[model samples]
Target: MKIRRANKEDVTAIVEMLANDALGEQREDYKLPLPDSYYRAFHKIDSDPNQELMVAENKEGIVIGTLQLSLIPYLTYSGGLRAQIEAVRIHENYRGKGLGKKLFLWAIERAKEKNAHVVQLTTDKKRPKALRFYESLGFKGTHEGMKLHI
Candidate 1:
């Protein structure tokens, strides 16, 4: 498997992966005639210098995994820069094969290369397995996070 920056053509596959799970069924739109909002968001992310949308592909070049990394410059923590990992997903056929670990480690290493002071991500509390996987990767659930949908 090879990990690389995602191109516009990879959006459809990524969206399918995003909608492959239980939680994704409610939040993601991977149906026929997908919404324009998806492409709009992709364009914004793709054009942003501080954002990276990545994909993992197999020997046949099919996208089987995806994640987004956003580098944020903050005034806090001695003017530190942080890299946030979000929207991580692996194709159902590719799960439980240690590919997720490789994808995550690749993101972390990319963050380090960018001189980020920290790497952070948040998982829905509903996913116990994901929480365990993250903790095993050395992430600490030290802070409480709250969000209000617009």
Candidate 2:
């Protein structure tokens, strides 16, 4: 397996994996000829120096996982940089293969390279299994995360 920055051609596979889960079925659109909005968002993220949209590929060059890491400079933590990881998804066939752990370890190291003070992520409350998976990776449930859908 190889981890690398994602390209425009990778969006479809990434979205397909993202939409494979139960919660994803409600929120992600994995249709062929995906809405151009996905590309537009990709371009915007690609242009940002602090953003790293990554994909993991198997030996056959099939995209199996993806995640987005973003760095935000904050006034707290003594003007520190915080790394936010989001949209982590592993293809159905790739789950339990340790691809997700490898991807996250890479992202954590990447954050350290960028001098980020901390790396954080939020998972849906609906995903208890994911919560345990995250805890296994040394993440703590230190704070409550809240959101309001508009």
- Model 2 lDDT per residue over 40-61, tens place: 9999999999899999999999
Candidate 2: clashing pairs of residues: none
In order, candidate lDDTs are 0.94, 0.93
Candidate 2 segments whose C-alpha is farther than 4 A from its true place? none
lDDT (tens digit, per residue) of candidate 1 on 53-106 = 999999999999999999999999999999999999999998999999999999
Give the clashing pairs for model 1.
Answer: none
In candidate 1 the C-alpha lDDT for residue 103 amounts to: 92
Model 1: residue 89 alpha-carbon error in angstroms: 0.6
User: Which lDDT value does model 1 have at 71?
Assistant: 99
- Poorest 10 consecutive residues by lDDT, candidate 1: 29-38
